[model samples]
Target: MDIVSVALKRYSTKAFDATKKLTAGEAEQLKTLLQYSPSSTNSQPWHFIVASTDEGKARVAKAASGTYVFNERKILDASHVVVFCAKTAMDDAGCSAWWIRKRPMAVSPPRTQKPLTTRVALSLPICTAKS
Candidate 1:
C-alpha cells in the first residue's frame, strides 16, 4: 500500500528452515526484482550473487565467518542467499556497454548516445546456482 505500511511490515529473518528450498519460479521472481529495483538517478552500480544450493550457500557463508559468524547458520539454512556488490567507479564506456547489453535494440547511434551515456553509470548482477 503506502511506503510507511510497507516499511512497517518489513523485517529481518532471524532463523531459516534448512529443510526448505525455493522453487525455480520463486527464485526467478527474486532475480527479476533485484534486476529492476530502482536506484538513485538509475545509476545501478551494484551486483548480486544469489546462492541456493548447499554448496552454493556454503561458499556464500564463507563471507560471514569470524566476527560475522553469527549469520553463517542463517545463510546456510535459508532457501537463498543474496550478496550485493557495488562497483567503486564506472566510466562512460562502461555505462554504454551495459546499455547495449541490456537493451540492444534500443541503442542509438554512438554519437547521439555519448552524452547520455556520460551521465549514466551501470551495474550488472550475475545470478548463479550450483548443485
Candidate 2:
C-alpha cells in the first residue's frame, strides 16, 4: 500500500480478524518499517517487544493501566502485538549523565530548557570530550 493510504488506514486497531496471522517475512517487514520510525536526536529510545501469546498480551494490558484493550481472546486468535519503551534513563554515558545531573528541572527558572539543547548536542554522535 502507498504511504498515505497506510497512514490513513492504520488506526489503533484494537480488534483484528482473529483468523489472520503474519508470515515470518511479513513480520520482518513490519519490524523494518517500525525501525524507521522517528526518534529524538536519533536516540531511537524505543524498544519493541513482540508478544504472540494471549497470556503475555493479557499481562501487558494489565500492566499498562488495565484498560489497554489487549482482548485476551483476540490476542489468542489474532497475530501479534508490539510494545515500545524509551531507553533514555538506562544510559550510562558521561555526557548523558551530565545532562541528567545538570538539568535543573523542578527548582530552576523556566528557561532551563537550554538543557534540551545540551541533550540534543550530546545525543549527536560528534564525540565532543568523551562518549
Candidate 3:
C-alpha cells in the first residue's frame, strides 16, 4: 500500500483493547514503525520510558494537572509511553540573534580560522541523537 494509504489506515487510538497488553514482540514491532516516522534531518530525538506500573502511570497523569485520566487509564493498558524531547542551545528563538552578535569582528587582517557564521551553519542537519 502507498504511504498515504498506510497512514490513513493507522488511527490515533486512545481507547485500547483492555483485554490485552502488548507483548514484547508486539511492542518492538510498533517501536520499529514509530522509528521510521518522519523526523527533521533524520533527528529521531525520541525516548521511550515504558510505564507498565500503575504508580508510574499515576505519576505521569498527576504531572498533567492531576487529571491524567487518559494517561493514567490508557497508558497502563498501552504497550509503551514514548517521551519526545529535542535538544536546544537557546531558551528561545530571540536568543539566537544575541548569540550571533557576540562574535568578534574582523580587524584589518582576516582570520582564516574563523568558524562559519551562525546563519550559514543552521543549514547543518539537526541533532538526531542525544549525547
The lDDT leader among the candidates is 1
Candidate 1: pairs in clash? none
Mark the regions of model 3 whose C-alpha exceeds 4 Å error after superposition: 34-38, 66-71, 90-113, 116-121, 124-131
Worst 10 residues of 3 by lDDT: 122-131
As a whole number from 0 to 100, the lDDT of residue 24 in candidate 2 is 92
Model 3 global lDDT (CA atoms, 0 to 1): 0.52
Q: lDDT for every model?
A: 0.75, 0.61, 0.52
Give the TM-score of each candidate. Answer: 0.71, 0.53, 0.52
Q: Quote model 3's TM-score.
A: 0.52
| Model 2 TM-score on a 0 to 1 scale | 0.53
lDDT of 1 by residue, 7-88 (tens): 9999988999898888999999999999999876455778999988889999998989889999999998999999999876
Candidate 1: list runs displaced more than 4 Å: 98-131
TM-score computed on alpha carbons, candidate 1: 0.71
Report the C-alpha lDDT of model 3 over 37-59, residue by residue, as the tens digit.
76553434345555545666665
What are the per-residue Cα lDDT tens digits for candidate 2 across 17-124? 867889999989889998888755555556788876677667665655457444655555568788787554433364454455545363432674554435445555
Output candidate 2 Cα RMSD. Answer: 9.9
Q: Lowest lDDT 10-mer window, candidate 2? A: 122-131
The superposed Cα distance between candidate 1 and the true structure at residue 97, in angstroms, equals 2.1
Q: Estimate the Cα RMSD of every predicted model relative to the unseen true structure.
A: 7.8, 9.9, 9.0
